[model samples]
Target chain A: MDFSSVFLNAALAAVSPANLLFCFLGTIVGIVIGALPGFTSTMGVALFIPFTYSMHPATGLIFLVSIYCSSTYGGSISAILINTPGTPSAVITTIDGYEMTKNGEGGRALAMAVFSSLVGGIVSALALLLIAPPLARLVLLFGPVEIFYLALFGLSVIVGFSKGSLIKGLISGVAGLLLATVGVDGISGVYRYTFDNVSLFEGIPIVPMVIGLFSTCQVFVLGEQKRTTIVHDIATFSDSSVPRMSDIKAHWFNMLRSSVIGTIVGIIPAAGMSIACAIAYNEAKRVSKHPEKFGNGSVEGVIASEAANNGVTGGSLVPLLTLGVPGNTVSAIFLGGLLIHGLRPGLQLFTKYADVSYTLLVGLFIANVMMFVVGLFAAKQVVKVTKASTDLLAPIIMLLCVVGSYAIRNNLFDVGVMLVFGIVGYLMKRWGYSTPSMILGLILGPMAEGEFRRALMLSRGNWSYFCSRPVSIILLVLIVITLVGPALRNRRIMSK
Target chain B: MTKYLDEYLPIAFLYALSAYFWWDVEDFTADSLMYPRALVGVLLVLTTLLLVFTLMKKMRLPQSKDENSPFKFCVVLAASIVYVFAVPFLGFAVSSLLYAPATALLLGYKRKGMVFFVSILTVVLIYIGFRTVLKVPLPTVTLLGMTL
Candidate 1:
């Protein structure tokens, strides 16, 4: 591969006017979505995807890249200002950020958060640039069985994400795979789950399911939560809102270490921003000299959470671009975007679509820098999203879902599918099933099925072919460990 | 309004769905049926496991215990269904103009003035974005000689 030319082309694409403007717009919107209590970064990307259908492929992707990176920063502003974390990843930031606001050091805390987010994002972006191309090169070596088990390995980790019961999560995941099998089978002309509907010939549209699960489900859940204001008091940004040199000097190690931790956690599929921040926060508390002050206006605490969450921004994209495995919900949406633009993830992406890939990578770093600048100036205004009325918000979200789904193929059936999935998603959440598992299943199921069938055909229906390959064997081992690891841990705890 | 999908109801639903899915694939060829049958079979076994876990009551499968008014959810859901139907007939602009406020009302928004204003604005913006900017072939129905 001509690495120099790829980097040069990417540099040009990233600086293109369309990429810059969309990147700016995506960052602002991402921030607002993150700052709102009910809205999320995944929802931001999913909802905005419709609006970006007309955009240039590189422009649209870079736009989403900005949104994915900046939304993590957006959550911390609300966490510091209103004591309510806008996103789950920002929950840890609230402990010290809120206390800092109470002590009139909100400015210092906010400054540190923005700085840490910037640092974390930059580090992970570097990781993505260096690691993704090599990973993609390795994926070129995979055969059908290896690819199939790799997806299974990805899906197996959802058990780790299970809130309560692993069986329930697997059930959700398997159901998603079933749903993905709807529409015409790609390899064969057979229609599996379409139920004789012409509208479903292409299968359930990804955009509709995305809008349903991430946007409409949130609308339904928030609709039931009743309208509530996130900002009560402490509703202003500090005048200076600038980090002190002393504080920066003190917490550089925490920021750097948390960034690395977040990046690594993020690269592991399904270990999302929330876990990254949680791990980083726990580690910060463990190593702090005055550990007791950790939750009480500790700058290290805010730095740890914000840095780790932002670190996930770049790291999540790595697997999505290189391996076609979404590290989290937002990256899942990103995969949908790339596919829509006719850019498949994996080997050919880094080679054939190097310009777009590099643009997204560089644009991500730019979004983080932009997030820091925007966070400095507009953090207070961003927190005002919590004040938006749910009455108005819910209907608007439904409207977006409908229009967004329809805009994909200009079909109304996608709109209907979105609504159905939304209601079903609401039910699933209320019933305590994990939605992410189901979503992952839906996204990965078809690929797994295709690979499984192809491998069988290659081996003339011999099942041993899967185990014969070393890579597939390794993946099978990974699946077993992913499934049984938690159970063994639970047993150990019980024995203790 | 089915408030809670109790253990038996969920199990029954899964059993019926899996049965239908299995029956549904009987017409397909052996190769075509492989994936679908495998999925349905898995679904059936999982549902059976769920039933066992539910009966045991110790494995503790999830139980829906939403306190939110199921009646309200039904109303909003019904409204959404109608709204989706309306779009093909009324077109994006008109249907959204009607659906947004109705949903707000169903979901307990009493501020009719603000709701209506926001609803109209949202509709107009969505129309421009989808029908105009994005150039989606949104329906321009003139049914009953009423242009929308």
Candidate 2:
């Protein structure tokens, strides 16, 4: 456990005036952005990244991590208050959260989100301490082919996320794959799609693409909606709105189950908060005595979603710090942040950067603790953000999107990409298609295609290679379940 | 003013766009085929499937009732293309400064004061952040013959 080092360094980093203050500011800003329906912790990390380019690596890493942790919880505020998720991870929160808000129990919902987020964070941090080292040993077995397949597996989440239409998800995934092909082919050195532009040599930048998909598209949707104002009225809350001990006692099992679900999902590369929240919410509802209460402001529902989503932050880091494989988009950025600071994530990261690493783990733990305090104190104000009209915020957010997109590479072509995706997203949203699926496809499709093709070549065009390896077989089985399990359940419910 | 054109036209355009890309893939062989071919293939396949699905189900997709589709969609797409082409000539800062306000106006913002203030301020903020703070390169389009 490196108890001595973890304790000494964590203590040092946790209490430092500058470090502590940065953590506080990051959380506050993170919660604000997360409370806004269109902004996400992913966007928060992306937008704030340029700012981090100036700070020391450790300080910068701390700031970004703090934002990532807090923003996951912050999303529930909007979900509870306005029935719109500020982040995809909080989508499940809206099912029950908004119901509670309508019944004038928004404060309690918010409190539960905070408490659960904290519990999830703390539990996962301890797990991080116990589990990360062994995982690092396992990661050493990964070669380029294995890494490629892993990336592919991560991207396949699009299949599950693609609304009712796997075709649309496939389209989005293929589109992302094609874009990933831009620039000189990494292996062949052949220029596949650069069209004579020098900038295309490096391939389309991930920062630009991500910003385009999440932020710019967000702007377009907001602008089109042209909402002017949002209603912010909720019956005043007394101190009792803070989750009571009995309330916590009542949901302890739900909390544990949800946190475990969140951690497991979070550990998988590319399966981010949205997946965790969805899984946790479903499980919570499944075992609930009042299952029907799930979508109607059930406190268990709020706990399940929030805890599971934020739990991803800790679970995600396990793979990242141990394996250098990012667990989700935000973790990918965190990897970049680590690299920009002259740190490489692999096994040596533990031995060489142990103090810094432990400090981050501890900081993550503290960030969750702080999330509870800040969230509880600011729950009222946070709800007001949700109440703000999407129409008004959309344009400004669009502006911010433009700024963020352009800021990444100072390229307008990237901005154009954002607008393109935005329109596509709007259309998909209107059609009841799953944007998450498309995003998953877009994010993971190329990785899967590239790796699957490469793995084939390495094995002399053998398809059974994936099945032969125990881990690969297990993962493939899990992937199949992830894809088919939901449909089976949905069908069962419908038939009933 | 009351026409079905607004309803069916966009879908038809998408259908056409998908078809065009689908056909365009034949221009290159596998080695020559870039990622766009796969993307276009997926897009065409999905759009066609969606089209069929919607038709079979008698589903009518949602469209804005404001009769603003053709113009807004066209303008938005055009603005994006123009921004890309203008970048090397106008440089990022000046182009963005000009583009933000202009695009806002096109999106239906009417107040001159708001437009001008937003345009100028947005440009300045971006300039300070991208140029000054982050030190990201903001090239000026010197070839455009516009000095400022």
Task: Estimate, for each residue in A135-247, the C-alpha lDDT of model 1 and write its tens digit.
Answer: 99879789999999878877777645557677777778888888887888787788776778998888778878878877888777666643333455645644468777898
Positional deviation of residue A90's Cα in model 2 after best superposition, in angstroms: 4.4
Model 1: per-residue lDDT, tens digit, B66-145? 34555556666777788889889888778888888988887787788988998888778777766676677565578678
The backbone clash count of each candidate, in order, is 0, 10
Candidate 2 chain A worst ten-residue window by lDDT: A226-235
Q: What is the TM-score of each candidate against the true structure?
A: 0.94, 0.74
User: What lDDT is reached at residue A24 by model 2?
Assistant: 85
What's the DockQ of model 2?
0.24
lDDT of 2 by residue, B20-95 (tens): 5445443345543534555666676666775676567644444443323445445555665576567667776666
- Across residues A1-496, which tens digit of lDDT does each residue of candidate 2 receive? 5668666876687667766777887889789888876677766876566455555556667788889988888888878777777778889889998888788787788788899998888877777777886677775776545655555454554454344545444545545555565566554556655667876677665555555556665555545544333445534544344878888999988888888778888887666788788888888888889998877779898999888988888888887788665677677656656754667666666666776777777777777887888988986786676654443344445555555556556776666666666666556555544444444443444455566556766787566776677677666666666556655765687699
Error of 1 at A371 (Å): 1.6
lDDT values for all models: 0.81, 0.67
Model 2: CA > 4 A from native: A1-22, A38-61, A79-109, A143-145, A232-235, A238-258, A268-305, A316-359, A387-392, A410-413, A416-481, A484-496, B1-148
